[model samples]
Target: MHFISHLSAVLALAPLLSLASSAGLVERADDASCILTASGGDDGPIFVDAVQRCETVVIPAETTLSIATGMNMTGLNDRNIDLRGTVKFTDNMTYWINNGFYFEFQDQIAFWMLGGNNLRLFGGGAIDGSGQVWYDAFATNDTLLRPILFTVYQASNVVIEDIKMLNGPEWINFVNEGQNILYDRINISAVSTSVNPAKNTDGWDIYRSDNVVILNSNINNGDDCVSLKPNSTNIIASYLYCNGSHGISVGSLGQYAGVYDIVENFTSTNVHMYNAENGARIKAFAGPGVGAGIVKNVSFSYFTEGNVDDPLVIDQCYMTNATECAAYPSNVYIQDVVFTNFYGTSSGNEKSVVASLACSPDGRCSDISVSNIYLEPPATYGNATYTCQNVNITGNAAYLFGDCATT
Candidate 1:
């Protein structure tokens, strides 16, 4: 009974690989334009079929599109798009044919889901990021031109579901300075092997935004599944399966002053991790008065780790340059955090994947609760450890002494 809840997560991470390939050709448009054809009617067979547009399309409610991309619908932020077409990549084999169309899209091709009042991408249509090249570049550390999702900025009321996102570039989806966004039932991946190392393909990067919900998504990448940057609040990531990556995280916050900091009100639950670096982590640098900020009201639960490096972690004084350590307090404030219903096994021979919180004494972690915890890391690995000070954390079997993630 101790390991009951976390044991179920062993089977939770199994993806529907039986499903068909969710990506395909770019569906190239003329002049890289977006084509939009909207038929006005209360409710006639509103259809959005296979069309690669070069310009924007004003798709009203109950309207459907086959499969459209590479275009921006100005003021179409809240439009409902019943993606009724097949959205799959031509093939990942084109990497061999650098002389063909794949080379053009190296710079020309990229699906831009941009500008709308209240936009919807439904009807089971797909959006492939064609991140194969991106993965390769990152693994090899060959290039530094990380791809970006900038044009799709400053839009409100967005919901993308049942859509397949295959092969994301550096940052999968970036929500910039916007609000009310939900990404549900999404399939995002960059599966890795000894030969293929998916690098830096983050699932969701919410930057300077608020009110976001990302749930029921299969995110397997080389970086954090979700990164809450500056001014991000009211964010929730649940029922997530992340594998072969860095893990779910929040931080590198306030890298530079006046970046509109303040990340609060976030919850992450029902998560399954596999072959990752750290299961759950919060890292902040030790720069000149940078890590000092107000980060509060965050909760985590139902976490199951599978063959991971560290099951839990928090590095307050993350140092990029140790020589400049005294520049800032390096003592970040973390409060009102909770972890419950935990269970899972570790990878290799390591049971030492517990909480590693290194917070500053001045303003460390407080008001935290950890209950109903169970960790059975392979039976052969080392034991987990909690490192911190003045933390009020207790409830279930989670051991602590110097744990700063408490009140």
Candidate 2:
């Protein structure tokens, strides 16, 4: 009780401290009251100076802050970003293509990377990524690399809340090598005006991180709503409404030849999925020259779907020809996965088959349980159909899905 009182008193006195005492406030860049614009060259040196001198930096509302170049924002502490305006990047394709950090794993690029401690970014504002041009260009040119909108790289103890992210060029958000990050009440959407749609616009990709939580968000995008990428553990995603997505998925892993991926201890609950291709899916590539790993202790519960195809699916023979897939089954083992409390309506295309679990013929799946599933086939079609192969059923509450077609 005493410590709480003391901390409160200290916080109350924080605003009274003189700006000259600890650090100064630089609110202008060469004349404007509170606006800072970056000219052509690298913008790192200017931001480094501002962050070092100011404890709280405010980007005023009704202004467009242009970033003409890529930046590397690193090694800062105790800062608050009060973003109330639009931050838009230039559409200089050649400059951006030559710049930004490169990740060879997925041929990914990032415009700017943020890292530090006690960092907070919030406001009723938006960050715009000029995506339409990239969308049209990528339709014809597959080799063009579009950069991610925002990346949290090598940072900890961060909170991002109550913001709007719009029209990202590629993946909207990527969190890599960070822990203790929380995102709440954020809005994300991407739509292309042209015929060429936005491609690979994953809402959130958590890779190589732990202890992350994302709650109460809406995602209308082109790809996975939230993907627990390779090496993502201890993650939680709840209360999500996803549309036009590839569903909340795990592992297009085992694609790379020599790498091992591990995804464990994750949960995604209370999701409303609509107009998607799949729901609650786990896909692994099957081939002799593929990676291997273990996925265990994961659960997807309390989900409701509408007009979705493959409402519940697990295909170990992902993206491989049937003959070759049978010849070389997946080496990655899947164990201890639970899918419960799902009720939904399936699309009319696959009228008879609502759920399919086509595991590896080599029996690489074990202890897979399903219960309380009520997925109805198309209204005019016949009864629901279910297929399960090479999996050990731990328990099924009502056998809602009929007899398993075990091989």
User: Which has the greatest TM-score?
Assistant: 2
Candidate 2: misplaced stretches above 4 Å? 1-49, 397-407
Model 2 TM-score, all chains together: 0.88
**By TM-score, how accurate is candidate 1?**
0.72
RMSD of each: 10.9, 5.0
Model 2 Cα lDDT, one tens digit per residue, 1-407: 00000000101112222232122323343211223343344334455555555555555686566666775666666665666876676777788888867877588988767778766667677878888898999999989999898888888777777778888888988999878788887788887899998888998998898877888999988888888788888888889999988898887778888888888888889999999888888888887799887788889899999988888888888998777777888877888889888888888668778888878876698888888888887878888888777675655642654555544
For model 1, residues 302-338, the per-residue Cα lDDT tens digits are: 9998777767766666764534543454545677777
For each candidate, give its TM-score against the true structure.
Answer: 0.72, 0.88
Number of backbone collisions per candidate, in order?
Answer: 42, 0
